[model samples]
Target chain A: MTKFANILVPVDFGAPSRRGLELAVDLARRNGARLTLLHVFDVPVSYAGMGLSPTELLAPMWDAEQEELDRVLAKVRDEIPEVSRETARGVPWREILAFIEQRRPDLVVMGTHGRHGVPRALLGSVAEKIVRLSPCPVLTVRAEDEA
Target chain B: MKRILAAVDLTSTAHLIIRHAVELARSMGGRVRLLHSVVIAPQVPPPGVFVPLTSFRAHELADAARTAMESLEESIPRELRDGVVVEIGHAADCVCEAARAYDADVVVIGAHDYGLISRALGTTAARIVNRMDRPVFVVRPMPTSHVVEPEPVSAKAG
Candidate 1:
């Protein structure tokens, strides 16, 4: 049988990421696989310079992001049989690569991020980096252009 | 997800790519169209004010690719085999064009061992993703040493 037992989706609550999640949910349903929604968490730069306990300073942010993740997951809970959520704290691309290495999902479904002062569509961004470095299949879902 | 366009390079990974395509087609109740692009190398005239005729035999390459594609097709279940297409031009362009012509819902492509150039610019798969409106599945090209040859389609059901 074709085994897509685990599929990972990195969400940023963006339109493209939502497109990716929708595709992933459908894929998981067809393949009878589970989905993992991973979101990279970053502490605001304001709290970084101070040598305080970063955990305490970032708790609220973490909680807030967790809630956001929950909200995202709730939308697809009924569609996927075993969908899970996670939050990683680091650079988005690096954290995603680390998660893939640690969890070794069969596929990664993510959306392409838009222009960020760099070359248009070239990204130099998370989706591009993950597409270049990811060890498994990566299905990139780009949002349809508005007419 | 009914129509899957699989772009394959005629390397060892071609077999693995076909396996992925077949498996996906089986699962999603889809039909797969295998596409191979015969990348034509650009020709330059002789230097020192000498202009000469030049030609790149893309047709021969396409024929060879077709033979190879047929070999790979043997491994695919007959039902899932939609067809095979051989195009002459840039790989990414051919893939997108074929996808559009076939009206494929998703495109499956293999990511290969790219050099420093692809790292700086972009891989073919990435370019396709940037341009194509639909989903593109980029299968990681496993290192040759670590790769295990795919078995027959009949035995792959396990």
Candidate 2:
């Protein structure tokens, strides 16, 4: 039997990311795989100012974000309770690759909006970059495919 | 007799695909053939020199291909050994052609699940899926060894 250890999934609190998380949960449950839920914080410039005290500026965002994570975990626990979470503050792509490098998950499952036409062409795609760069195999689930 | 064909690239993904194919072949009482294809790029002349180009050794590539197939065969359960077959060629074309030649009911493959463009136009898996006559089961690269629970028979049904 092939064992999948350390399954890492990057989420953005969006519907597509949620779908990816759901699938990852199911796979982890079935395989007894250790699951890591990752959320990358792509901080805007306003947050970068040194003037604002950590609590004065970042408190609300942290509270809201943690609340969302709680909601997401709640849903997953409703179905399967075994899951772990991690949060990283950096670019989505770099942080994801760095996390993979540090932890070395067997698989990285991510969700793509699967945008088309102007949106897809102009923005390129994070999923595409991850596929080309990641050492471990990646599963890029389309938003609609999960439904 | 039902036949199963597994494509390998000598990557970890190959291990996943071969294992899945072996199980499927075992359940169906079918023979399994493991095929690998090496995409050899044509040699190009150096910028200023026009030297005679060296040809690639088809046999050499085929030998490496056989080795990859054997690697997969070694990982599979012993009962399925007699039915295993290995060959190498242009991955996309070889996979589709081998299936036709062997009359394979299904070809097991692994794809790095990406967007529609990536799925449809990027990888050899997409190209093989498009060209092959037989159904190609695309296995997600998630390793299943961690699942402590018994695999539901239905998990492998597809």
**Candidate 2 stretches greater than 4 Å from native:** A45-57, A115-124, A145-147, B1-7, B10-158
Predicted structure with the largest lDDT when compared to the true one = 1
B158, model 1: CA deviation in Å? 16
Model 2 lDDT tens row, A1-147: 434556788888886687678667866776667788888776667667677787777777877887887777777766666677888877788888789868877767776555343321311255555655565556555564422
Off by over 4 Å in 1: A50-57, A114-120, A145-147, B45-56, B114-122, B144-151, B154-158
Candidate-wise lDDT, in order? 0.79, 0.64
- The per-residue C-alpha lDDT of model 2 at residue B14 equals 76
Give the per-residue lDDT of model 1 (tens digit) for A8-92.
9999887888888888898899998989999998657777789888778788778888898998788889888699998888888
Which residue pairs collide in model 1, if any? A1-B157
